[model samples]
Target: EMVMPGDNITMEVELIAPIAMEQGLRFAIREGGRTVGAGVVASIIA
Candidate 1:
C-alpha cells in the first residue's frame, strides 16, 4: 500500500486460532536506509 508523507496509517489482522500458537508478525516501513516506522503483531482476542 502507498501512503503519503506525514499521514497516519493503521493495520489490523484477524486470526482464527490463538495468537499464542503463532510466532507473531513483523512489519517495517522504510525509505532506503531510513526506517519510517515499524510494528509487531499483538494478540487481541475476541
Candidate 2:
C-alpha cells in the first residue's frame, strides 16, 4: 500500500544499510528501483 503525505504510523520494515541504524537515522524509501519517499528510524528491533 502507498503511504500518503502527513501520515504518521508505526510499521515494521527491513533494510540493507551500510551503517548500523539508531534513533533519528534517516533513509530513503525506495520502490521499483527509485525513491518514493524518505523516513527516519524511530526504533530498532532485532
Candidate 3:
C-alpha cells in the first residue's frame, strides 16, 4: 500500500493468543530495503 506522508494505513491480524499480553511483534515498511517507517503491533480487542 502506498501512503502519503500524512495519510494513514491500517492493518489487522488475528492470532490464537492475545498479542497484547505476550511480547509484541515488529514490523517495518521499507522501500529498497531502507526503512521508511516502522512500528510495533497494536493490539485492539473487539
Q: Candidate 3: which stretches are off by over 4 Å?
A: 1-23, 44-46
lDDT (0-100) at residue 8 of candidate 2? 74
Per-residue error (Å), model 3, residue 37? 0.7
lDDT of 1: 0.64
Model 2 lDDT per residue over 1-46, tens place: 7678888767798656766779999889778999878888988788
TM-score of each candidate?
A: 0.32, 0.62, 0.38
TM-score of 1: 0.32
Best model per lDDT: 2
For residues 1-46, could you state the per-residue lDDT of candidate 3 as single tens digits?
7776767666665656753443366777678989887666666457
Model 1, range 1-46, lDDT digits (tens) per residue?
Answer: 9876776666775645654533366766578989887766555444
Q: What RMSD does each model have against the real structure? A: 6.7, 2.4, 5.4
Q: Rank the candidates by TM-score, best first.
A: 2, 3, 1
Q: Name the lDDT value of residue 2 in candidate 1.
A: 82
Overall local distance difference test of candidate 3: 0.65
lDDT of each: 0.64, 0.81, 0.65
